[model samples]
Target: MARWHRVFRRWVLARHYRFAREALVPHFFDALTAYALELSRLGVPHAKEAVAALRELRTLPLPSFTGEVEDVFFSIEAQLLEHWGEEVAGALRRGLSRNDLDLTVFRAYLKDRALLLLGDLLRLRKALLARARAHFGVPLVLSTHHRPAQPTTLDHYLLGVEALLARDTERLFRALSGMDRSPLGASALAGNPYPVDRRRLAHLLGFAGPVEHTLDAVASGDYALELAAALALLGTSLTRLATDLLRWAEAGAFLVGESLAQGSSFMPQKRNPVVLEHARIYAARLLGGVGTLLALNHNTPFTDLNDHSTGVLEPLSELLEAGEGALELLWVALEESQFVEERLLSELSPEVMASEAVDLLVRKGLPLREAYARVKAALPGVRPETLGVEREELLHWMGLEGFFARREVLGGAGPRARAEALSEAERRLKEDQKRLGALRARVRAARFLLARGLEDPQAEEGQEGEVG
Candidate 1:
């Protein structure tokens, strides 16, 4: 029941407590306090044991529990490091400063969080791929400027989203691997003479090795910032996809699949694309995190600036939350959302067949521009076969024959690439699944920023070994 000021003064701030309260407290502050004890353990072999024997009941920083825990810490120090209460307290002038410790801990924590975020992103990719598979050949009309523009399959569209996500998943892994080195050995920007085994600490923390440069280790939150940027980008892409679906489905013409909507409070006929709308808002907010982090580093040293840390919570929180729910939600939406053959068939105007018409004119010995002009005269808004070409052979010769056939180029909207992309997406989804699990393990070791609904994206079908 002690006031914060009294607790701060008695246990934490009687002396040498020259730090901001805000910086001193976070979810991981207790971890840092335990880490300090671990350091004390190095100098005093039975220090931790003695403290435990004192019935402290915990080994973490707790001003609230200071009556028990701090007394134990004192007892252990007196019995082991100190001369049995003769030298109860003293400050060391050499070795690592708390600043260095902060740098090291956060570097470790950020690496873990990045891995977790990566895993969530991977789940999203799998969900998208599964949706893609179920809808590839299912026909739908592609819209440009919110109007039906061309014939496209659901799979082709999802493939574009999948490709972007695949790249994002790769970026996350690269960030994690590159940033997974331990910074503990860097102590105070110069190596300590106490012979502390940095690599041993790295091993304890599951890092590949100690960071190479002490100064660099102290200064680089760039890895986390890069990860933030990447996550934001990935979120933006997912949001974009979601935003499109919300718009398309709301239009009512693309009602090939059942609507993932709800009635409004005031109106009965109001089926809102609420999730997509939220995603759109969150995507922008996630993008803002990147900007804020960048600006935080702009005025300060590029190394682990506190400003960089402070500005991240808003964007990162939004991104994680959005990914957790929006991903699974959209996957379900994509799965149920059917491709309207009528909407697609309606797009079959001869003007959509214009490209083929020009080709027909060219084959007929007309100049390319003349052919274009002739076709231009034919279309303001019309689908393929709606053009003047009555003969299928003429249209076939012109290459507007089949929507799928005309798109057989190397990376065009060909069924093969669409199928291939979906397969690749599925394959990558598995990689993501494995990667997601791995990343989640890493993050759980660091913090509690785990998101929701990341699991079960494609659980209805056995997608474990089946994406690519």
Candidate 2:
């Protein structure tokens, strides 16, 4: 087997295999081999004896075992019973079903994927920060109505992107919080017959708690729903960003320094904003995947196949892979394109700062609306109502003493808010790093046990459970 397969096999041998085997002790069920690896993890005392007995069925000198029913999960547990010296066949009998088991597996899988996505988030933040730092004071154009309105720092322009991504990170964490429950005891629809510890199963699966009730456990799929929604929002934000990049990086705008060129079969010169184009298309693709998932499970039974604790496993897998890849690639592109703002300045004239001018006039004692009209009339064109002032003078006037300070109030792009935002982002990075480190340790320990080829089926042990 490949190294990763072996490692995965080892994890299956330890935790997952043990749980499933314990869940199905009797070799009676046919589709149980799906959980055989977990059987090995259960560490039942009668395991070897059970294995011996099952082997006899296979090796019987009779035509008894006719149906080639899959039972590796239960059969392995039976085989290893002697080695464990104890058995939970009684408890396992009453409290679980394939439905709950599959949901529980999905929870575990999403937890792992969430951690992986955190890594992508880190790189994304880093990309934005690098751009901000490199172009901290580079002048660029600001726009509204598809027309340039005023000038601003190039790095200041990227601040909007940083703010959006920061919001996405917040949304991601909020969505993840919704998936913290376990549904192990919610067998099929009602629940298992036994008083098997549902909460304990949750603890075993690294969940925050049991999912309240049986039906809710089996039927609840809000995690997938909310995650898809959040992802859609994120995709939309990405598309907006892509839109800005594509529009502002035009040959005419010349606000982005890039040699995005390649020869086409028929054309002599085919320089294009390929990076921004890819980002735009991929953002659409991301949104589409989320939409597809929603449609796939809309009419399914409460605990139906299509839901699979989500719209469908296949689409989610695609979302995770494609979204992360596109974001990562964008990070590289973000770091490359230097912000070229001279053309941007030409487009976004001194009047885009008209709001600041209005604020200035308002402070000078004019009514807000009157100040706005006064500044509007004094500033620019027939479309904007132009004033013939020198651009350099207006630029300085825009950043005049009171203007910068007054605008910095709270969440505004004032110096203080920018600093506070940066600090908050840094603090979150540290907290997430600590959490990520713990998750890696858990995954790595799992790998370590598998590599040794020496694991006894057992419940999960880590900081995740209330009980070890």
What TM-score, computed on C-alpha atoms, does each candidate reach? 0.72, 0.70
Candidate 2's residue-wise lDDT over 1-468, tens digit each? Answer: 233355545543333344333332222221122122233234433333333344334332221211222223344334334333345332233334767766766665665666677678667777776676666555565667877655545555666676777778778777767766766667787886543455544543445677887887777676777777767777787788778777766644533325543446787655566777776676677687666767766776775652344335446656766667657656656766655645555654455567766665565677998766767677463122333345554455576343445557654555676556566656766776676677567545543433232232454432321111
Stretches > 4 Å off in candidate 2: 1-96, 251-263, 303-311, 341-344, 355-371, 378-396, 399-406, 440-468
Candidate 1 lDDT, 1-468, residue by residue in tens = 644567556645432122222223342332333333334435534333332322232232434333332222232333333332322123221254444555555555556456556655666666666766766676665667866667667677778877887887777677667667766656666665454556544544445666777777766667667766776776778778877776565655444233666668899876676656655665555666667667666768654454344344334445555555655565556556554545545555555555666776687788999878767866664323543456656556544336577687755687886766666667767766776676556445433311110211211221112110
TM-score of 1: 0.72
Off by over 4 Å in 1: 1-96, 145-147, 253-260, 301-319, 322-329, 335-348, 380-390, 394-401, 436-468
Task: Give candidate 2's TM-score.
Answer: 0.70
Candidate 1, residue 359: the lDDT equals 72
Give the number of the best model, judged by TM-score. Answer: 1
